[model samples]
Target: MAKRILVVEDNDLNRKLFCDVLKSQGYVVEPVGDGRVALESARSFVPDLIIMDIQLPNISGLDLIEAAKLDPALRPIPVLAVTAYAGKGDEERIRQAGAEGYLAKPVSIGPFMAAVKGLLAQVGAVAG
Candidate 1:
């Protein structure tokens, strides 16, 4: 089966871009605009990977990643933070919050797709 990816981003253009790119790559993409909705949608879809914006409405992506890590069912799903916050220490903070990878915005397609493939490999590693 094609890997499933959940994309949580608030900006319309960003979400569309990410979703479109992943879809073109043959990933099943489910895009949500808010962190709260992301949580609910994640439970239902149980994606293999998540590409999330660190700043989100209702709840921050960091909070969402932390919450998912705490859940037994969701803990194995890898989350990659895609954000504008590429400031010093931001990558550390994202890792500390349990994100498997980080990508800063405006994301470069090549690196972004490479990161996605890497994170999907992680899921395969754990599952196998």
Candidate 2:
């Protein structure tokens, strides 16, 4: 089966871009635009990885990452955080919140896919 990836991004264009790229690479992509429903979607989808956007409208992606890390069901899933407004310490903060990977936008396809594959590979190794 193809690896499942949940993409949580507010921007329509960015979300579509990520979804398209991942789907093209044969991943089963679930795109979520609302931060409020992200976790619920994740739980239902049971994705292998999550690609989160930091600057969400209502809730911060960092908080979502923290919540996922705390949840027993979601804890095992690897998260790759993507943000447009990256600050000096933002990456560190995202890492602290339990995201395994971080990328600043506008993200290139190569690096984006690399991070996704790397995180999935780690999961495979752990489960292998």
Candidate 3:
């Protein structure tokens, strides 16, 4: 089966762009615009990976990541933090929040896909 990816982004253009890029790479991509819906979708979608935007409406992506990590069922899903906040401490904060990897916006498709693939591979290896 194609790897399932959940894209949690508030911006319409960015969400569509990420979904399109992942879909082009043969991933089954599901896009959610708000952090609240994202948390619920994560449960139902049971995605193999998550590409989350840090700044979001209702709930922050970092908070969502922390919540996911706290949940046993969602904890194993790899989360890749994709955000425009590239300050010196931002990456560390993302890691602290339980993200498996970090990507700065505007993200290049090559690097984005590479990060996703690497995280998925790591998860697969761990699972096996």
Candidate 4:
């Protein structure tokens, strides 16, 4: 089965771009534009990986990551965090929130897919 990826990005263009790229790579993609419903969506979709955006309209992606880590059902799923604001210590903060991968905004396709594949591979290795 193709790996499932849940893309949580508020920006329509970014979300579409990420979903399109992942779909082209043969992964199942589910895009969520609202941060408030992200956790619920994750629980239902149960994606193999989550590509998250840190800055959201209502909630912070870091908070979502932390919440997911705390939930047993979502804990094993690796998260790849993407942010437009790459401030100092932000990467560390995101990592601390339990994201296994991190990327900054204005993300190029190369690095974006690289991180997605890397995280998925790691999950596969552990699961296998």
| Number of the top-ranking candidate, with lDDT as the measure | 2
lDDT of 3: 0.93
Residues 1-128, candidate 1: write the lDDT tens digits.
Answer: 99999999999999999999999999999999877888789999989998889988778899999999999988889999999999999999999999989998889999999999999997788888
Q: How close is candidate 4 to the true structure, as a TM-score?
A: 0.98
- In model 3, the Cα lDDT at residue 7 comes to 95
Residues 13-122 of candidate 4: C-alpha lDDT, one tens digit per residue = 99999999999999999999999999999999999999999999999999999999999999999999999868999999899999999999899999999999999999
Clashes of each: 0, 0, 0, 0
The lDDT of each candidate is 0.92, 0.97, 0.93, 0.96
TM-score of each: 0.96, 0.98, 0.97, 0.98
TM-score result, candidate 2: 0.98
Model 2 pairs in collision:
none
Q: After superposition, how far is residue 120 of candidate 3 from its true place, in Å?
A: 0.9
RMSD of 4: 0.6
- Scanning candidate 4 in windows of ten residues, the lowest lDDT window is 84-93
Worst 10 residues of 1 by lDDT: 31-40
* Residue 120 local lDDT, model 2: 100
Better candidate by TM-score, 1 or 4: 4
List residue ranges in candidate 3 displaced over 4 A.
none
